[model samples]
Target: MSEGTGAVTNAGEGEEVLQPFSVTIGATVPTGFEHTAAEEVKEKIGAEASISKDRGRIYFEITTDNLPKVHHLKSVDNLFVVVKCYDNYQFKDTKEDALLDLQEIAPVLPWSNALEVWKLNNSVKKKRSRRRGAAPKPKPSGDDSEGEKLQAETSMSEETEEQGEVCPEQDMSLQREQNSETIENKPLKFRVTCNRAGDKHSFTSNDAARDFGGAVQEFFQWKADMTKFDVEVLLNIHNNEVVIGIALTEESLHRRNITHFGPTTLRSTLAYGMLRLSKPQISDVIVDPMCGTGAIPLEGVIEWSHSFFLSGDNHDMAVSRTVNNINHIVKRRQTGGSTSPGLPIDTVQWDLCHLPMRTSSVDIITTDMPFGKRMGSKKKNWDLYPSCLREMARVCRPSTGRAVLLTQDKKCFQKALLRMSGLWRKTHTVWVNVGGLHAGVFVLLRTGAIFGSTPENKRESQKASETQVEDMMENI
Candidate 1:
């Protein structure tokens, strides 16, 4: 192993090789939500996940090698098979040295490269044999004939080559084939995905990773007649170290296909994290008053089948989007999709500050509050947050009832919660990354007692009441 590069070299005399089947697979969760995501993995995934967190990402490991099984986890932002990690690597800082270090740490092409090397030696051996008047021995034609194997491999390769590159259908088939076959064989098809997270670099991390990728491509194609494998190699370079992994899902799981549209619709992963934080019960009556696109309620439907969900948004367009997505989500589940059968969902078009449900009815309230950027104004949020939270406290079951609110306006939300401190008790406050927005998800437990209005509240109330009476008298 190289001290500067943290690169592992082949053993000279006696060495143990890593088995391909023993690869480590893990999930990448949103920033500031590692503990929740990891808990979900342990509970839902049941893999006893090991967590490693970075600034904006969390890497989790499981015992199982089944990448597909863990790929579609709701809370996971991305899933990948950890290919290699260079611990405490000392980057030489120069582009040339970085490329060399990357190349050194990259996973070895045991099947392709070793076979190519052997083939080269045989090619020279064949020439010598021709000079000595000796021809290669024939492979017997039976179930294990070399001819059949070569033909099958050739057909598979040609189909992949004909597809040009990045063939999904071929890639899936190749993954299954590779997993089933223990024998050393070339990879089907492959690509490279590199991510660099640091500042003031000597060279672009992309160029360094790509240079390494290109070198890998060259190494596999060195002496082989044909090579086709579509493996998306992931390189996460940061903190003078490179953590390499293979992307499990072609597209991110966060991009829920069910949600076709929503300008301010919350991301599914964030919704999932909030729901998990709330610790919802199957018997709980859940609601998301500002359910712009129903991402939260939709996730609830998929996650827990028995929970009763009531979602609403005051805006007509937002309600329409939510309704359409809800219908689509149900339809997908009904048509043998992965989601479980949830009870009928109720959609409403009502204001969050004034919900239609009776007081102390709802057991849980989970909502993505307006961030004042795309949906609502920060000035308006001062009043809206307080009113919405008060209404939530009114509807919540008090004491046992909980509301998990996601918002970027942390200061305003805290103020609102503090103003109506008697109505609810703050249980937890978590900072999470939804895309790039630094947001907080506050969990509050409703305190059943409805305290009398304070002197300030009374005066404000009296002024509003007097104005209302005057308006009524004038109208009469």
Candidate 2:
């Protein structure tokens, strides 16, 4: 295939060259949202993604012209360009034999295209970094400064020790020869990161990385630098499957949105997944009653600019943090030459159980509730969930309105939903991983039953009167 329009040119040839080819791109997403991420890839990049269930990964093929679009995907946490994939790789019986096989395969894989893509991605990332006002680090000079010399020495020592079977004398001699030969022409620095999952594996991830890395160094004559590497190679092995790739993202993209963080900040990637589940439409009034830093509403306003978002929390700190995060985005937009630097979002401080919004006003409600671990207690949630859910039903438009609520207190939430069955109907549920805690995202639709006419409303009114009578008797 001929390279597309944005194909990389050979550095020696000072002209643009068209070489058409397709490469597989791998992305890591929130574990339970693999389908959500794959759907996003299909919608935005026009690529049909293959989802690896329960692994939080998806793969799709795209031409070089679409590389920049891959970086802009909101559902992916990290991106990598695949060099090669083996669906059913055979492992040798012994650890040494398996690791040796990995080392032997490094030189024969298709590295040219992936490396070219990596080079092209550097320009894209640099442009983004500059826009974010992040200054780039100066390239290390070839001159043997004391720090460089020490780092090189330390790296050699560590590699030798990690291999355990390497002859220190031979390694030092080889290093000296390699250093002398590349003194004039500096080689790219690199590191190998291996992630292996499977109980049947004979080798640890470190063993595979070290042996494979040594072979890569020998084949390319590249220097091994762990911290300041120019390139990162990934070795992902799961069961009989193996995928070798070049890392395209230096850091996880989930940090792209938030500036000011609260005690329990939800990941932006996960937030996007939750928002996608809501299926937002034009002019939808979305509300997050317990917005804690306003992550949900902020993500909603950015992705679905047609929707208006209202974020509120009872805590003073949370309200302040939400406002700060919104202002940061406004400033960024203003700097980017936006004629109107305002987002369709607003923040307030209010109790979740006593929202100030009028009944039947909101179209959608999405919020990440306190998991009772970091933010609130389990005892409090027992009381909090049912009360807030009632209030949510009051504001949500009947039949057409929906809410996506995430919480680790599933038992409490389920019980609360049972009490509000007259007002809310659970339509779907997605189990997700949040900060190592197992949580559920419940998708509930508002029942056609009017606000105060529900059986739940009558029960709440009776309970409130009973409590008021008890207080009055104590005063008398």
Candidate 3:
């Protein structure tokens, strides 16, 4: 989200001392992708970074002099620098006692004009958006429905009521939460997520949480902005403990600067995670046959300097988008950026079922295949999967080469896998939560040869495979 790409910034600084500080930063990722995100954190941010994950989120504790490097980490959604972790956050505790607790934490934290505060412990889980042309899905609603609206009114009403308190520094951002159906239907301009967990002794009611939020605004001198906010703060409360930190970037890190995108452009973070799991090495010829807008190859070139990329898609529009995005990357590189030369790269527009490649020519492959309700046809995939897998097997190097494919059509994909059990071996399968869909990421190793595998031979096998697929789909 921030402009820089995780490089050392401001070496001669005030807070960064000779002895690097022990800092805790939060990294968020799509569900079940924490392992890969944690790897990115260690590789990009700190060599000795201690990482932990909860609810698909990562918390990294590292002793580092360079904080900007952490800011530039890919495969992460949001980044937070922890200011404090408290043992107790009882807003309903005695007024004097609550004030005292907030006082101790206030001075150490660097306050912003506008703050987006959230609870990590008892936070609400957001509902995912529905695929296009599918049913009109509901928005992600959290349990703290009224809590948000209450927090907003209380902040504005209370602040305005205490009309005469004169303060020298006024960096308050006025952010109010609206709970109306009209506002809810529209995309959220800004959001403050509250996570409440561990020990019910603190919040006697939802107002208790609202009051605490007001206390935070008052202590930090932050103004609530219903329209917008400059910073996001995560409050993690575990039992009697609470940890607070401000986001390192204004927007989520997953939102890259790529100017062009396809209808199904893969998430940059997911693309990075897939590459990491692909076990790419020097001289590895990696590929993404379904490469939409070049996220996979673009991320690959940036992270793996030794590898070359072959990105292709069946759609002409996808190819155009990828080319445009590559040009932008090149422009950025000229003005001094971290991405490797976008050289040793090639693009193609062809049918996935009939790829033009030599047997055992490619070293590795990774692609985000079509999924979702309307995005892909389960019936068509029955024919497409086997054909595409055969072509992919023909291209990848035998015995040692690998691929990481993501798709939500588990039944169809598994049917294809079962039919071609000898050609590819499934090494790992991880179910990742993407836009509310449980996408299975398959890591397959090229085990059998496919130089002259005839497509005609599959007609007989198709009849049997379809029967098994139907049964599997029923159980699913």
Candidate 4:
């Protein structure tokens, strides 16, 4: 393979083969899990990632041969092949000047390597689609084929007219004939998507994309398509930084796991980050007390198959959704011809304050608590948080157990933690963005104190079961 270019030379044939070229890959991860995503990239891909801190992005270099490994990553939402990156881009003071500069740079920038990678990625996507049971592309009818032939001829005529503008009639005829020989080669359809940031920018993302896209169209003679495009070119601008890339993923990787949906289903990518924070061990029994749609436990079982997962929720609908999602995955595996098509996960319906398990049985507990906006209310959280935490501590093994809980009600969670200080100790906190709501993923370790011996635990157990039942009804 060539050092910078993604080309190789065949030894026996002396032919240049386009194979494994180096490219800079960029990934968008969940906000606040940037470092966590970067660490996964390093461990899995063996490449050092440069975190774009607070921006939910990371960049790393990898050969095209290693591209498949990137798709297996759990933390990234989207992937793109970096064409160019300018850390200190100096935009002109006026919008027109800035846009003009962008247009002028279109043809001069490197495109061959990135476009090749994009072509390779298309094959990868098609293979994955087939594996997922996507229908094959329908062949064109006779009439449609004839229309496409006419369109290709018209395009050839346009190109000939432009090139032979000042030439004789015979030269124009000759150019047209030459272009007609390659009418079967269709021009690629593409769209430019611009993401612009910075208060000082004089142009909107659309304005930049329009001007830059026009220049790119003129240079490459490719069609401009907004929706049905084969290529997606990205123009990202953040203050003084600018990056140009080709998208590698059509849909976000977060949608890879779950098939069944719930009202408040968590993103599988964020669930992976939460699991990473807990650091599950071999043979560990992890449990999710409030597994809304079983996203966390499903992700855990898939990534850490050696560990067992138990998912439970108080609501009947939530439990059903979890079961359906797990069955969908098991069926998918069975279809894939696995001898033992069962996952190391099970779903149950149980109250958060009273789990159906032995004390000190679970090795880890991770859950997404109701944030009072969609599932429950702030008034109920006052009673719900403390009760659940106590029960989780009871089931979790002391000193060796850990819990990673995500909640938008930081104030309420912190208050409850203060009350249960004897059973759980806050070791780390990761602030995250969940659908525009800022939340915290609190990482707590089980203290050495036994469950019933703590004053907090005794007080929690002394609360009337009647009041707990009333609170649960109110939440429902």
Model 1, 1-476: lDDT tens digits are: 11011122455565433222333454566677778877876776565655553444455444322333454567765555565566576877687786776676554623332222222222333343444445233221112100000000121122211111011111111232112222246443555555666674565655765666666667654222233334445567666656766554434455463344566656667788888888877777899998877878888877766788899989887788778777766665575444554455788999776689897899899998988877779999997887787778778886788889988899999998887787789987898765466788888888866423456435434654686689799999
Residue pairs with backbone overlap in model 4 = 6-21
Please provide, for model 4 over 48-108, each residue's C-alpha lDDT reduced to its tens digit, 9 standing for 90 to 100: 9998622877999998777777877888877888888888889999999999999999999
Global CA lDDT of candidate 3, please? 0.59
Clashes of each: 10, 4, 26, 1
Residue by residue across 1-476, what tens digits does model 3's lDDT show?
A: 11111222343643221233355666656667787777777677654433442355667665433444554577676656666555444554565565455445655554321121221110110111111112322221112111001011222223210000000111111112132422225332322233445455434323333555555566545555533643344455545656666555443444363457555656667778888889889989998998877888988887776889988988888888788777766766654443554466778998786678777899998998877454568888887787777778778887888889998899999998887776789999988876566789999998865545546335534654686689799999
Order candidates by TM-score, high to low.
Answer: 4, 2, 1, 3
Q: Which ten residues in a row have the lowest lDDT in candidate 1?
A: 144-153
lDDT tens digits, residue span 38-123, model 2: 99999988999998522777999998767767877888877888988888899999998998899899999888888867765665
Candidate 1 Cα outliers beyond 4 Å, as residue runs: 1-21, 60-68, 107-189, 222-229, 337-342, 451-476
lDDT ranking, best first: 4, 2, 1, 3
lDDT of each: 0.61, 0.77, 0.59, 0.77
Model 1, CA-based lDDT: 0.61
RMSD to true structure for each model, in Å: 14.5, 10.0, 12.8, 11.3
Which of candidates 1 and 4 is the stronger one according to lDDT? 4
